[model samples]
Target: MPLVNRDQKHYPGLAQTTNYNLSSFKAAEIITRDVVVIGGGSAGTYSAIAIKDKGKSVVFVEIKNRLRSRTETYKDPKSGRGIDIGVIVWYVTPRVGSEPNTTGAVFDLKTGRGLNAPPPNQTAIGIAFQIYTQQLLKYPELDAGMFLPDPAPDDLVMPFGQFASKYGIEAALPTMYSFGAGVGDILATPTVEVMRAWGLSLISSLQGGFLTTARHNNSELYGKAQTELLAAKSLLLRSRVVYTERSTSGVRLVVKTPTGNKLIKAKRLLITIPPKVEILKRFNLTTQETSVFKKFLNTGYYTSVVKNTGLPDTLSVTNFSPDSPYGIPKMPAVYTIGSSVYTPGLKLAFYGAPLTNVTSSLPAKTVKDAIIASIKRQQTANPANPTSFNQTTPTFAEYHSHAPFWLQAKAVDIKAGFYKKLYALQGIRSTFWTGGAWRAQDSSDIWRFTAEQVLPKVLKGL
Candidate 1:
């Protein structure tokens, strides 16, 4: 376990500039920042801000141009927003629920699961949510764009058809069940993992009725983040870190943009992308270590988003896909999303799942149509059975449209030693790691907890 000092990567911003000193060899474009954070998603960016606030210099880089995708906030043309298949957020406090709910922790004994904790109340995701909420509350600037109390849930229930019957919950969700996309196999996997996934889905698989902001869109937070980071020049949007090296001189980072590559030399690195084993192969971790990381990346993910049509208030909604009577996996032309939208505009974002084929890969449109077809079939089938319903039946709704990857599956073995190795990497190459894959599931929780847990350590190490 090698440790990277917090101050390991910072060189004072060059106050005195010297003219070109190129002598056949290029000097590492080394600028000293107390830390180098990678990825600009909620986790990476938030961690950078936390470090910066502590009076440490930091830089953040991301391959994406914007910190957020429209899919994260509003419904995209490609991906509709009926059901928020993404990790539906839920805030938890004793006040949100009745007696017996854990205040600091996310567990809600009444529902037999933690507040949105993945399968069997795994604490990571729930804790991340709690942490993120706490951070936002502390930093009024960040809290401006979010939904506070309405985001928290009182009873965390399992995902069964019972929602329709219980509490008479009427909410529409995207059919990420898209003809058994990882549903069966994931269910077939170990008990705990399946429980976590189901728990997240169950909580998010409802129609609208929760809280939202009054003015800005849900993604305003990302915008707010960009403004803060840009003023500091620590945020690099639309830039990709193509190569990183730990040289005797320092940690060299090559960030690529449309213009060209910019060399950023730092003392440390923090990686936030999903741990794709193949991508990790590019790291300079001796063949053996690189192979291990690549193996972790092999675990994989699936992407999806649903279409939400504003339904009347109090009108509960759910969706089903059609299939042949012979029992082949079927899909609906267009699936419903979120509880019938109380407001206008279509709400097309809900549930997502992992890649089931273990080797199956389809383009977004193909998958979208497949999902739509499955939902259509389910809608037409008898109330008792959707997949096994006769092909002759007609569907409840008919609209063929594209939807985003509501079910983006980032498969992880959690094989036990995975996080151990990741933590080990923290100071080794003078870098850090953050994102849902490391030790979280949603944006808020990961930001909050990581800010407290990782940032302080980063500052101290510096």
Candidate 2:
């Protein structure tokens, strides 16, 4: 059982020795551990357990009071059905006989349900895959071992738009970009970045197929993680790392929690959160680290459930203009929209526009309103059956911002080995890093990489 310093919350098997206050330690509560992990998302939670399994103590800190960051459950009173609000599906390819099946499917991790994917442009996907494979062969560093590079690959850079054109798969851009808001703008995105994200090989057959949320919704992943990680000595909920400092010997983090301030001392630190400039500023990063971090471009992706969208249930919304490259026909950009999101009236929307188009700093309501407006415009803008009709203004049922997602740099930065320098920071000043930026986006891939590659490095520091 792990030992907790405070008694504000209770875990099933942990010992909470809060009755005895250590006033002698300092003005604030001080707790020491072998490792400290920041962020409670898939990578951090998995890292904590993997490290603990290796016989090291860990302190898990999360700004939110939950283990899952984007996964949530939305319950509708009318139908009494709970639908997933975030982190829904895992893509996978099944097998036929002894060979792999070209067709893909979406598997629900929690429920073990498999939904067959629409027939993809195998010709287009094939060309892209072959090109990426040849690129990987040329530069082994670009290989996505399990999910992400153990150390990020450097100098492997090209825009997805360029890669597609080079391979005559520009026609398949629509199919490739169907992943919705999780992957921001596909055309302008980095080629290696896109390959790792929803790469044909990556999602083809890692675990035989994709996985999704159960009836309980997407929170199942986090719930399971929280249950497993409860044994960690220090699991600080509703906490934020207000200040941080590192030395050759160890790291010191000042955390603000619901209970009070906590001074956390640990031999190593694992940061799984997106390395935002504003957030990293608190960590006291070196000039080199700051320069590398600042180069990363963050996207604006938002997820939400809306009610009373005036558009017909038959139509879905996607954003495109006449100037869209390669003559790809306009299609629904919002991805999947289930009538059963929470109830029949509620529809889920994954809105992703460029940060330049929809700034990250915008409030959730503001973004939601913009999405509703876009939906309304899309309903009437179709040239095939253009009709101007005023429908009831849609309102948000719930909102979640998965923004600052897909952190990437320009082609020039990649050629400069920015990722190599970023990974070289590992064990420097006793700090390590992981997250979507470090690798692919899928939870399964992140967990696999964490177990196989990241934990071993973390163990070395411990």
lDDT of 1 by residue, 279-386 (tens): 342344544355445444212223343333222222222333222221112232222233323333332322233333222234555545554454343334333442
| RMSD (Å) of each candidate, 1 decimal | 13.9, 8.9
- lDDT (10s digit) by residue, model 2, range 13-91: 1222233222333744787899999989878877887778788988899878788887767777677777677776654
What TM-score would each prediction reach against the true structure? 0.57, 0.78
The global Cα lDDT (0 to 1) of model 2 is 0.63
Task: Quote the positional error of residue 308 for candidate 2 in Å.
Answer: 1.1
Model 1 TM-score (2 dp) = 0.57
| Residue 226 displacement in candidate 2 (angstroms) | 2.1
Clashes of each: 91, 8
